[model samples]
Target: MKKLLKRIKALIRKIFQQFSSTLEPSPPPSYHSPETWIPPIPPVPSFAPQWENGLVLVCSQCTVEQFAGSSHRINRSITATEELQNWLKSRLKFDGLWGKYRVISTSCLGICPQSRVVVVLRNHLVGQQCLLVDPQSDREILYSYIKQMNQ
Candidate 1:
């Protein structure tokens, strides 16, 4: 039993020595000094297509709960934005009007309503108008407002 314990202790020491011998030494602190490093050049930024009239930024993070009878479901913000985009495309298709407007699904605009997504409209005339849009009810009103601004 004593001889077995002695062998185990010797094996552990040999394993530790092998592990230590396999490790490479860390570099000296002076090797990573700031004066020896060169700064990397940053790339120029590219922008989206320039719109003539305006653009709409819809919040993709907004989630709204809808209840029907006994069951309820959450409405995704993306579908609402897509619906708004389609509506805009259909209504504003007159003599380059559609080309001037853009609908973009963006991150949260920070005005997250409990039952609606935040829609920000920007044009040369109005500058900017932030509104909470209910997809089912506010489509017509929103279209009219955007039309008024473009004209």
Candidate 2:
């Protein structure tokens, strides 16, 4: 037992020595001399709600999205269209955007159909084109469609 323990200790020492031999020497700690250390000035950040390529608009007036704004005739599904709109807005990083895109809500879109639809204004090869969204679209479908539109 003593001989076995001795062999194990030797083996461990050999392994550690091999590891240490392969390792390079670390550099000395930096003192950060005053002339060498120049602090960077924070940049002035500019933000805009509208993307350079596309615009996403949710239909707040869609009867399926909200019961208060909608009538009994708009009860088409259990899930509201507002969830899809919020998801789209989050994916587009348009949260708290009250500048440009906020004004184009569904109530202002003028599409008063019962279907829960969204509007996508995309900059295609021929300038800006409007897209009519499908009511049956879920979060994944809406995300994919928005991604495609942006591309």
Task: Output the number of the TM-score-best candidate.
Answer: 1
Per-residue accuracy of model 2 over 40-91 as CA lDDT, tens digit each: 6899988754555555666666644445564455545544556566555665
Cα RMSD, model 2? 14.5
Question: What TM-score fits each model?
Answer: 0.56, 0.41
Listed per model in order, the count of residue pairs whose N, CA or C atoms clash below 3 Å is: 0, 0
lDDT at residue 126 of model 2 (Cα atoms)? 31
Candidate lDDT (C-alpha), each = 0.73, 0.56
Identify the runs in model 2 with alpha carbons over 4 angstroms from their true place. 1-50, 64-79, 93-106, 124-136
Report the lDDT of model 2 for residue 101. Answer: 32
List, residue by residue over 34-62, the lDDT tens digit for candidate 1: 65655557999987665768987777666
Off by over 4 Å in 1: 1-50, 64-78, 94-96
Would you give me the overall lDDT of model 1?
0.73
